[model samples]
Target: MQKQTGFASILLILLIGLALTTLVIGMVTSVRSLQDSSLTTHAQTQAQIKSAIGYQALTGLLKPLTATQIAQINNGVIKDNGSPAATIATYKVVTTTEGCPASTGGKNYFCYDITAKSGGASSVVRAIYTDITTGGGSFNGSIFAGGLQIGHTRNLQGDQTIQVGAAPGGENGVVKGNGSSTFYDDQAQFTLATGITVQEYTPTKFMTAEELRASANYIFYANGKCAKNNLYGASIYNTETEPVTCSSISGITVSGSGASKKWTIDAASSAIPVGVLWFEGEVDINLNSSRDLVNTIIATGDMKVITTNQSGAGKAYAPYHYYLEASTNAATKKTRICGSSSTGIPTQYCDTAGTLKALDTELAKIANILFLSNKNITFDVKSNSPMSLYGNIIGSGGAGGTGASSGKFTGNGTIDIKGNLSFTGEGLTVTNGTVNVKLNRGDSSGNVTPSKKVMTLSGLRYM
Candidate 1:
């Protein structure tokens, strides 16, 4: 009996020892599992932080440290606490030039590779660029480029192919290669042109007056008619407030049909020419004649002239003509003509009461009407020397009394008057130098009185 009790006691002791050993083993396993989990968490946190830094650099939201900005980013990112399992990383930026000049000159490109180093591993951010003209002429991208692993052997070497922007025929998502792709996740954070630069242009505001006055003899046209009339219709005005230098004219031609008159310029001889002409309502005819004669046409028009006391010297006047003194001229000075015949003023202002102009105002009105009427009237005149014509001449084969004072004329002919001539009209013109009888105004007075010459035309000689 005593031996049996002893065996049971020994077995109970062995069982207790076994149980304690098992418990100890389980606790050791639990502790090891917890340690492994903690290590994994720390590694993951480090990876996430590193990746976040890289992403921020790539997107440009966080600008690349301008030596100054970098210091700030680093100070904010890396804490001074001694809780890190690994040492803080250092960074270096590297640049590469492939098909570009060493220094960015015309069309030079660059790639920037930024690597952040640590004890165990390293992280890098890259960017490839084409815009070198923005930042002091150099490649200014992220830290990594060329898909090269940071602190790894798998990084690419040599010229890493880059892309510019979207090409014509490329994939929808991302095109690859230099011909297709515009964006690269490897060589650069962005694509780059083969070689390119940028520049800025600005204009200055300091010019001399002489530079502005370089242009002369400018012609300006306004409204429906011109301010001056040459042979062709009327000429534009030169309102430069100064004299305009122009070439000389020798002669001109005039011809046309209908109520319009055409005047053409002629360059046959050498002669001093008039500067400009003013046509109110007549068609101007420019003729290609050998002499300075421009042909014109006349229509049935009326003449109204008012005379002011033209001169102080006494002068004799006939029914239609006026005899001036040899020296005291009566027709070569200022004279005013009105529309009323019963006003008792001579057609030539023959009374020596004031100064009389050789050119008659009524005649000037008639000429302007014919030139601007744009009608047809055939007449020709030319001059090699300076001359003037006064009074009025009626055409159109109709008794002259009523005439249009304003109209347009068109043609290519000649009517040369070197000296000043007075022409007036409200609606009458010679068109293209064509003789048209429709423009004639018959005896408007309605009186069957005998025809009386109202005025005489002087300084008018035809060839």
Candidate 2:
């Protein structure tokens, strides 16, 4: 019996030993699996972090780069100091013309391929960016010129900003002039509240004088008459004396009385389909103040305005305002031009094609009269004639072309302007009576908004 009991004890000990061995193997397997998983998770985290760093570096360098410079960048590596690995992240820029949509006008888009590696593990990320213009050609300032001058009592309010190029025979590109007979900023008669902000002058790339003349929808010559008897009431003086004789004649609708005339021009119904009107030579305007609404007028020579004496409170309307490409000459006496009691005219009357829908909808469009010349812009404000201009005025030189002599802006008598006055000319001189100048916000683009260059990111991927 003792021997049998000893045998049973031995068997029990062996079984317990086997069970202990199995438990040890299972624990070892679990530990190995856990360690492998932890290593993989750590590598992935490092890779992700590195990838983020690379992406940041790429985006940081792209904002200020011009389109030409961006196109030249390829296979470029940008490093970040805060990277987790010993080596900084690597980046490659690939430009492709195939991917960009047709709407971008054949402009090339950019592809950024980024790679980051740590501990033999790597992560790759890709992003695509589309090129665009932020605000088109930079206007730089509200007024741009080679030289500037201002007259007495000339209130230049509402973001009175100006940019001047190098003057003729002046050092650097600094502007020179001011005051009654001078064109220097220091000698100007107006007081500088925040002071006149000056910037280096750059030629206007927004639109050129030659381009304006070439794109003129209506071309008028000297002694052209804007007769009220015909439909659309304007005729170019040619061989034909009829009101509708001109090939590009258009009509204007006018309303109101005295200094309160409202004008509307229809783009669709007019013989000249476009909004631009070009005057080739000196033209005279003899509108029976009762029937005329003017749009954009681009003059190549000189412009003169005269109203008939049969006045029963003459009314006029001009929505987008006028653009005088050359010089201007108007009646020195008080004559009612145009005015509006309403905030703005309806879009149906202003723009028929709806191309200027934003102008119609937002009412952000400013009614401005811009005189771009290399000569002089004269505004006659005589006594007993309260000449009041309801829009902004921009008198600039070099409207004829580059290297042209800067023009002059002169005003006389009781001249009342409800908007800003900006001049990039030889000087501005206002004499005789009180030259009342107020400020109003108007559209700078007339009524047309042209497309500009811009850059934006689109497709993104990871590898």
Candidate 3:
């Protein structure tokens, strides 16, 4: 009976020892678990704080950060708030090889890989990224909103200017946007304060021909009649004449020679002789020489119809010489100068001489015919402004060629005109063959005196 009681006591002591050992084991496991939880919490908070700060710093850079730049953070290329140190959080930017939302649409984004360490164990928190948005937190110093890279808005205006060289590689050349205030998707449109308009003018018709003629200062007559008579109430200057009957004729000869020809008529020795020659073929009234037709006469014939054998040959006749000589003869009617000799003379037809010689009539007719023909010839005549030539301006050239000789003109043939040239003034005398030009100077009050100014001619050498 005493031995059984001692056995029970030994069993009780063994149970108590087993229970104490289990309690110590449980306490140790609880302490270790709490420490692990604290370590994880601290690591996670540090990583989040570091990532937030890093993202803000990155966004401050404005321009997108390259992958290599973000890689520096992952590779521990970073600094703490006060020192260069490696934190629990590692970050990088990837343009590819990651399915991150920041890398969506084939773009790049910032990525952070966080790990918590305690004793010999580690916990990893991965897959944090950002995208651009209007208002969203950044990650690892990277721009983020709506899980994509963010872009800023720009407003440009005309009154404002910009500095471009502030950016890199843009030191010398700067393009400014001053016209438009805002740009979107690389497009810009602007407005202005004012616009533009246009206007034109039309003129009224001028007076009729007869009206102008009646009111004009000068009269123009052609072919013994005024062309503008129907427009202006101007009468044609016409004279009546009768034909004459010749009783006898003398001092007349028709002659031609090899390389030369002439039908000579001389009335200087005789009182007055009038005769006519009938030509069987077309005739040429040759001037002095074929090469010098403008200044000389080779022969005179009954060739009433004058033909030019050379391209630039000219016929020049002066009625003044003939008119001055015919006035002396009483039998030569002055009014019958160019009209039929049977007509009575107009007093002005004769100069001081009462003689009405037929020579003046013939010569006047020749001058009129030659001068009128030259009016149809075309030549290079230019002026600084508009100018009028009162008389005939004859240029010498062969029948169809442009010069008198093989390749030469009769004389220095160029006509160069410069400055103001007028046609009519008080002293402006224009005869049948006169080269009339007007020169004038304006006074301080803008008044002009045409006769006082002179036109200078240069480079005109008679060849």
Cα-based lDDT for every prediction = 0.26, 0.43, 0.25
Q: Which portions of model 1 show Cα errors greater than 4 Å?
A: 4-6, 54-89, 94-463
Question: Model 2 scores what on Cα lDDT?
Answer: 0.43
* lDDT head-to-head 2 vs 3, winner: 2
Q: What TM-score should be assigned to candidate 2?
A: 0.40
Q: How close is candidate 3 to the true structure, as a TM-score?
A: 0.22
Local accuracy of candidate 1 as per-residue lDDT tens digits, 137-184: 111111101111111111112222221222123223222332223433
Best of the two (2, 3) by TM-score: 2
Ranking by TM-score: 2, 3, 1
Q: Please, what is the TM-score per model?
A: 0.20, 0.40, 0.22
Cα lDDT of model 2 by residue, 1-463, tens digit? 6657688789999999999999999999999999988887788779878888878778778766767787788876656555553555787765455343333653557787788877667888887877765221313234445454334334333344555555444435244333223433442433254234555554442332233443333334334433111112133222212333343354533344333332333322323232334444433333343433244444443333333344332222233443221112232110111112121122222332222233432212322333322233444333333343434344443443333444332333333333334445543222223433333333455423222345667777786
Each model's total of backbone clashes: 142, 22, 45
Evaluated at residue 463, the lDDT of candidate 3 is 11
Give stretches of model 3 more than 4 Å off.
Answer: 1-4, 62-76, 81-89, 100-463
What root-mean-square deviation over C-alphas does model 2 reach? 17.8
What CA RMSD would candidate 3 show? 43.1
Best by lDDT: 2
